[model samples]
Target chain A: MEILSSFIKNPRKTTYGGEDNDEKIIFLLRKSVIVNINWVTVAFILLLLPLFVSPPLSKLTYMGMRVINPGFILALNLFWYIFTIGFIFQNFLAWYFDVLMVTNKKVIDIDQSCTDVSETTLSNVQDVSSKVKGTWGVVLDIGDIFIQTSAEQREFEFLDVSNPSKVRDEIADLVAKIKKRNGS
Target chain B: MVPNLPIRQLVIAGKIIVILIMVLYAVFAFILTKRVKLMNANLTTPQSKLFERIARIHMVLSIFVIILATINL
Candidate 1:
C-alpha cells in the first residue's frame, strides 16, 4: 500500500509530458511533419525501379546465359537497399523536426535536429493572423500560421500544420483569456 | 552490329558519378551534424539525441557508399 502510494504521489520523470493537464495546461495547438507528398512520391518511384530490374538479371546470371557477374547484381541490390533505408530515415527526421506547440504562456517551436534548438515566444493573441496557401496545401488541409507581434521580432510563421482554422481559433481564445487576465 | 561499349568504361563512369554523389552527401551530412551539435549544446532534449543518432547513421551510410563505389570503380 505504501509503495503504491509513493508511486502515485511521485510519477517517474518523463521525456515528453502528457497532452492533458489539470493546472491550466493547454493542449498542443499544432503538430506537423515536414514531408512534401510530391517528394515522397518521387522517392518511391526511384526505389521501385531496382525491384523491376533485379529479377531478370538474377535469373540470367543463375542460368549462366549472360556474361554479367553475379557479384554486380548483388552490389546493385545492396545499393538499392541502402538508398531506400536512407530515404526513409531522411523523411522521418524531416517529420520529427517540424513541430509547433502553443501553451497558455507561450508558443514553442521545437525544431528537432541532432542539434536541439527551441524557439519560444509569448503571444499577444490579438495579433494572430492565419493564412492557408497553395492548391495542394488547401486540399491536404495543411497550411502556415502567421503570428504578428508588436515587438521588434515582427512575426512568427508556423508552417505546414493540418487544419489551420482550428489552430487559429485556439490561439485567439488563449490570447483573449490572457488579455482579460492582464486587463490589456 | 554497332561497336559494343567497353564494360570496364561503363562501370568506371558509373562508379565516378556514384562516388561524386556520395562525397556530396557526406559534405552535407557533416554540415548538418555540426548544426545539430550546436543546437544540442544550447538545449538538451530527447529529440536532439534522436536527431544525433539519425545523423550518425546518415554519415555511416555515406562512408559505406563511397567505399563501395571505389571498389567497383
Candidate 2:
C-alpha cells in the first residue's frame, strides 16, 4: 500500500523546501501511473526480445568455437539486462519525481527529470478548472486540472491525475480561504 | 565475412569496447544518483529515502557490471 501510494495523485503527507512552518500540505499530485504504460510496454518488449533471439544468437561464433563462447554470451546477456534495467529506472524516476504540490499558502509544480519548478502563491491563484477526457478517463476518474494563476506563472496543467475535480476543488477552496482571510 | 586480421584480436577488441561502454554506463548512473539526491533535497517526500537508496544501489550495480565485464568479457 505504501508503494502504491508513491505513484498516487494525492499522497497523505509530503513536504518541500522553503515551506512555511504553518503551511500544510494539502495535495501531492503525480501523473497517474497508468500513463507509464508507454515505456513499460517498450521495456517489456525489449526484455522479451533477447529470449526470442537466444536460439539464433547462440549459433554465432566468435573465435574457433561453434558457438561464440558460453561465458562471452552470458556476459553479453548481462550487459543487455543491465541496460534494460537502467532504462526502466530512468523512466520510473522521471514519473515518480515529477509532481505538483498544493500547500495552504502556495502551489508548487516540479518536473524532476528537468529539475524545473514553477510555483504560485495561493493569493495569486486566480482560477482552477478540471478537464476529463475520453472513456478511460471517465471510468478511471483520471484527467487534467488546469490552474490559471495571476502570478508570473500563468498555467499549471496537472495531467492524467486521479480525481481531477476533487483536486481542483481543494485548491479552489484554499484560494477561497485565502481570500476570506484577507477580507477579515 | 572473414576479418582481415585474426579472430582472437577481434574478440579482444569487442571485449574492450563492451568494457568501455559499461564504464560509461557506470558514470551515467553516478550522475543519476547525484540528480536524485538533488531532487530529494528539493522536495522531501515520504518515499525520498527509498528513492535515494535505489539510486545508490543502481550506481553500485552499474560499477559492478563494469568489473564483471572486465573479468568475463
Candidate 3:
C-alpha cells in the first residue's frame, strides 16, 4: 500500500481539495522524511520491547514470585501485541493523510490527526520561498515551504516536507502562470 | 468441589465490568470510523482511502477482540 500511494510529484485525478472544476493538481507531498523516520523508530522499539520483557516476566512467574496466572499472562501478552500493532497503524494513518498539495489555482495545506483536522488554502499567492536548514534537513533534502499570499490569514506553510527547493520552484512556476493568465 | 460463593460472584462481576468496558470502546471505535468516513467523503486521495480502510479494520478487530476476551478470558 505504501508503494502504491507513495508521494507523486504530479498526480492525476485527485479530488483531495474538492470537486471544484478547472483545478489540476501539480504536486502532492507528505511531511519530511524525518517525521516518518521517527514513527519507524518508535514502532521498532515497541516491536522489540516484548522480546526483552517477556523472558524476565515468564521467569518471574515460573519462580512463583508473581501471582498472575500463566493463562492470564499469556492473554495479556497477546493483548499487548495487538495494541502495539494498532498503535503503529494509527500513527501511519495520521502521517499518510496529512498532506501539502499544490494545484494550479491554490495551495492547500492539510494537517490531520486522530481527533482533529486543520486545513488552509491560499489562492492569491504573491511570493514563495523554501528553506532547508539544520544538518538533518540539508542532508536529507527536507524542509519547509512558505507561501505568502493576499489572503487575510497567515502565510500558508508546508511544514517539514521533503525537497523544499523543488516544491518552491513548482509553486513559483504555477504562480507565474496564474499571473500571466490573469494578465496582472 | 464447589467454588466459594463470594469468589464466584466477584468473578462474574469482574467479567461484566470488562464486557461493559469493551462495549463502550466498541462505540468509541464506531464513532472514529464514522469520522473517517466523513473525512474521506471530502477528499479522494489514495492516503484517504488507506486511512479509511485502516480505521474500519481497527473498529471490526476491536469488536472481535472484545468478544474473544469475553468468551475465553
Candidate 4:
C-alpha cells in the first residue's frame, strides 16, 4: 500500500505523523522503482558465492592451516549466515520505512537512511513540479517530486517516488484550495 | 623447514578473536535496537507498532545467535 490505499476502507494511511483538525492524508509513498534494492540483491549474491566455490576454497584453507577442522568451519559458516541475515533485515527496514507523506495541509518526507525529516505546508507552497527522467523512470513510472515554498526551508523533494505527476497534481490542487481560502 | 604451530594454541586464539568480534557486534545490535525505539517514540505513527515489533524480533534474534555462538564456538 504505497500512497493512497484505494483498496481499503480507510484509504489514507500514514506511517508517521498525526492528522491535525480536518487534516487528512492524501497519499503515503515509498521510494519508487524496485531497482532501489539492487545493492541488497548484489549483497545476497555475494553471500551465496562462497557456497558454490567452497570446494576449491576449502583446499586453499587446508593448505594454509595444514589442519582445518570441519567442526570449526561449520561453526564459522553458521556465524556468517546469522550475520548476513541481520544485515539484510536492517536494510529492508530502512527501505520500508523511508516514506513520503502528503497531507491536505502539509507534505512530510522521512529519510530512513539518516532519519532526517522535512515538511512543507500548503500555505507556504509557491510552486510544485515533478520529473520522470531516464529510461528506467519512463518505463517503470517512477520519478522525483519538487516543491518550492516561501518558508526558510524553500525546496522540498520527494525522491524516486511512483507516479510523480499524480502526486504533483494532488499537491497543486491542495495548495490552490488553501490559497483560495486565504483570499489570495 | 617451517616450524609447525601447535594446532590447539591456534584454535584457542581464533576462538578468542571470534568471541571479541561477536561482543562488538552484540553492542552494535543493541544500539540499533535503541535507535529504532527512539524513532518510534518520536513519530508515534500508525506503523510505529509494526516497526517496533520487527525491531524487537531482530534484536532478540541477534542476541540469541550471539549466545549460541558463545556456547558452541
Candidate 5:
C-alpha cells in the first residue's frame, strides 16, 4: 500500500539518534519472561495472607464499633490498597524501561528510574571491557560492561547486564569483522 | 503509662531518618548532574541541562514523599 511505503520512508525520530540512524540497532528487553512469573508469584503470596486475615479483623472491628469507628479501619484499608497498587505500577515501569541492546557497531544502554525520564549511553563495541565482580555476580552470570571510547574522554559503564560474557564475545566478533572490512 | 511518649519519640526518629535519606539523595543527584554537565560541555548540546532538571525534580519529589511518610508515621 502507499501508506506502508510512506511509513517506511518517514520513520519515527528517537532520542537514541536521528530518525535515519535510529533503526540500525536491534534492541532487546533486559529481563527474561521468567522474571514476570517470579514477580507474580511473590505478589500472590504477599496478598494471600492479607486477603484472609483482613476480613476477620474487619468483622471483629465492626462488632466492636462502640470502642472505635469502623470508618477509620476502612480508610486504613483503602490507603493500603492504594500503596500496593502504586508499588506494583512502579516495579512494572522500572522493568519495562531497563533495556540493553547490541548494535552492529556499538552497544546501547537505556535506563528508566521512574515515569518521567530515561537515560541512554552509546559506546563503540571495540572499546567495551567485560568485568564480573563479586562472587554472586560470577555465579549468576551478570556483570557490568565498562566501555572506554576514543571519541568520548570518559568511560561509560553499563551496569548489571545479564550474560555479560556472551555479550562481550559477540561484540569482540563484530569488532573483528569491522576491522577486517576496514583493513585496519 | 508512658502517655503519648512512644508516638512522640517515633515521630522524632522518623523525621531524623527522612532528613538523612533526603540529604543522601540530594548528594547523588548533584553528582549525576555534574557528570551530565561535563559531557554536555564536550558535546556542545543543551539536552544535558534538561536531564539535570529532571533529575533535580526526581530528588525533590523523593524527599517530599519521605517527609510525608514520616509525618504519617
Candidate 6:
C-alpha cells in the first residue's frame, strides 16, 4: 500500500477536503518514489560518514595538539543523524503531500506548500497531453500530464507522475463524457 | 589556525552549540507535526492516520533526543 501511494488508480477509501459524498478519486498522482533515490542515497552516506570521519580526526595532530576531542564525537554523531532524519522526513512529506488527483468531478493539484489547493471541473477541460522525457522516465514509465482548461488557472500540470499516457487518456475520456452529457 | 583552547572548554562549547541547533530543530519538528496534521485533515488517505502517527512520533523523537543531549553532552 505504501509503494502504491505514488500512483494509485481508483483508490479505495481515499478522500480530500471539500469532496462530495459520492465523489470518487480516479487517479491519485504523487511523484514517483524512484525520484527519492537521490536524497535517500545521500542520507545513507551521511549516516555512515561519522564512523569514517571521527577516526581520522582523532589521529590528526595540529601543532602538537589533538584537533578534535573524542568524547564530543558521540554527541556530534547523534546531532548529525538527527539532522539527516529531518532531511529525509522533509523530502518525503514534500513528495507525499503535493498531490495531483483526478476525480469524477474535477482535477485538483495540491502544491508543495501543503496549504494551497487548485482545482478545475472536468467540464472545463479543453485539452490533455502527456509527455515522457529521458530514458529513465520512459523506462520507469514516469512522465507529466498537461491539462488545458478554461478555468481560472488555465492549466494543471501533473509532474513526475507514473503512467502519464494512461492518466491522460482517462482524463480525456472523462472530459469527453462530460462534454457529451452537457451537449457542449 | 586552530585555536589551542582546552579540550574541555571546546567540548562544552560544542555541546552548547549542538543543543542550540537541536532546540531550533525541535521547534521546526513541532511546526512540521502541525503541518502534517493540517495536511491529513485536507486529504484523508487510507494511510492518513498512520502518517499522522508517524509525524507525531518524529516530533517526540526529536524532543527526546534534545533531552538526551542535555543529559549526556
Candidate 6 local lDDT, A46-158, one digit each (tens): 88998898788678665676655555465567667777877887888788888988888889999876699998888888999999999999899999999999988989987
Which runs in model 6 stand beyond 4 Å of their true positions? Answer: A2-4, A54-75, A182-184, B1-4
Question: Per-residue lDDT of B1-73 in model 2, one digit per residue for the tens?
Answer: 8655676767788888878888888888899888888888878778788888888887887787777766765
Candidate 5, A73: how far from true, in Å?
5.6
Model 4 pairs whose backbones collide: A32-A160
TM-score of chain B of each: 0.74, 0.89, 0.78, 0.73, 0.55, 0.87
Of candidates 4 and 1, the better by lDDT: 4
Instruction: Report the C-alpha lDDT of model 1 over A41-145, residue by residue, as the tens digit.
Output: 878887888889888766752223343446556655666666666666566555544445555565545555524333343544347767778997778777778
From the highest DockQ down, the ranking of the candidates is: 2, 6, 4, 3, 1, 5
In terms of docking quality, model 2 is: medium
TM-score for every candidate vs. truth? Answer: 0.64, 0.86, 0.77, 0.78, 0.48, 0.85
Using lDDT, give the best candidate's number. Answer: 6
RMSD per candidate (Å) reads: 8.0, 2.9, 4.8, 3.9, 10.4, 3.2
For each candidate, report its DockQ versus the true two-chain complex. 0.20, 0.52, 0.24, 0.36, 0.05, 0.44
**For residues A1-184, what per-residue lDDT tens digits would candidate 5 score against the true structure?**
3211101112222224321353344333254333455666766665565677567755652223422234434433443443344344445434544544444445455554422222233433337678877886777776776666555435556666567777666655655676677566
Error of 3 at A141 (Å): 2.0
Q: Candidate 1 docking: what grade?
A: incorrect
lDDT of every model, 2 decimals: 0.58, 0.79, 0.67, 0.67, 0.48, 0.81
Q: What share of the true interface contacts does each candidate keep?
A: 0.12, 0.48, 0.21, 0.21, 0.00, 0.41
* Window of ten residues with lowest summed lDDT in model 4 chain B: B39-48
Candidate 5 CA-lDDT value: 0.48
What DockQ score does model 3 reach against the true complex? 0.24
Residue-wise C-alpha lDDT for candidate 3, range B1-73, written one tens digit per residue: 6533454455557656765766776676777778777666655665567777777887787677676666644
lDDT of 6 by residue, B9-61 (tens): 76668778888988898898889888888888888877777777877887787
Candidate 5 chain B lDDT trough over 10 residues, lowest sum:
B39-48
Q: List where candidate 3 sits over 4 angstroms from the true fold.
A: A1-7, A55-71, A114-123, B1-28, B47-49
Best by TM-score: 2
List iRMS (one decimal) for every candidate.
6.8, 2.4, 4.4, 3.9, 9.8, 2.9
Stretches of model 2 off by over 4 angstroms after superposition: A6-13, A62-67, A134-140, A182-184, B1-5
